[model samples]
Target: SKLFGHLSSNSSPLFIMPTGRTLTRTEFVKRLREVISSFGINSPLYSGHSLRIGAASTAAKAGLPIYLIKILGRWSSEAYRRYISVSSSTISNAFVLMSKI
Candidate 1:
């Protein structure tokens, strides 16, 4: 799986120093900024978490089953339900049934 593959490739040592040091959040952000700059994206709209939200939102819009999305995102069922809940407009449209009086 992509997650497993990423984890395998991103291994780090327990003690991160000059010889075996882990990157701090600031360093990670700097590296991300450098990559974005390299792409010449002056105003990138998306960040790392954007990708996660995008995936969940896309799946919801596409009408995929919520359980499948939960598995894909590794979210708890309640969290997944909250994540994919539809807007008022969508729910109203879906259930707007009228019969002749």
Candidate 2:
């Protein structure tokens, strides 16, 4: 179906299956939870959705251009704007760089 079609074309091995079984949302969440648990991180804030948010946040923090991040995350400009919150340190670092230039 639609999900299988999407997965078939996905480039990430994380999204593929040699068995041809599509990973459902529930399965994905369960796997995420298992991974987190294996890492011994008991933080309740970590979840499947957090993975997506964290990736986008990391990309933003790493100075990846907003336009590039928007496309990589498959988010609209508005949606990406809402999700990416630049940390105070990021702003401070920018200021320091400007001072040295």
Candidate 3:
């Protein structure tokens, strides 16, 4: 019996324990840590929210428009702006580009 497997007889739930129960937040976090650690990221600081932040940061770095980034992140408020973390070089490059105009 797999702890997290779908019973072929049932197809409603995408993920469920052998007991047909959804994972609690703690269990989910533990599994998240295990997966992260397997990838050589043993940091205890990673959480579910980290995924969201990473997505926003990556999109911002990729030069996606702010409106599109907000749409991709499903952020209705300006809170998504805070999730974007740009490198100092990016800022310096922006200033250089601005001066060219």
Best by lDDT: 3
Q: Put down candidate 1 lDDT per residue, 8-80, tens digits, no spaces.
A: 4554432255856676755655666778788888625545555467778888988878776766666655665
Over the stretch 1-101, how does candidate 2's per-residue lDDT look in tens digits?
66544534554445545787777777777787788888888745566668778878888888888776766676655676666778898889889999998
Clashes (backbone N, CA, C under 3 Å), per candidate, total 4, 0, 0
Off by more than 4 A, model 3: 1-25
Error of 2 at 98 (Å): 6.4
Clashes of 3: 0
TM-score of candidate 2 to 2 decimals: 0.69
Model 1 CA lDDT for position 7: 38
Candidate 2 Cα deviation (angstroms), residue 57? 1.1
Q: What's the residue-level lDDT of 7 in candidate 3?
A: 33
Residue runs of model 1 more than 4 Å from their true location after superposition: 1-45, 85-89, 97-101
For residues 30-80, write the lDDT of model 3, one tens digit per residue.
888999899898649898778779989999999899987876666779998
Candidate 1, pairs of clashing residues: 16-20, 16-21, 17-20, 17-21
Give the whole-model CA lDDT for all candidates, comma-separated: 0.63, 0.72, 0.79
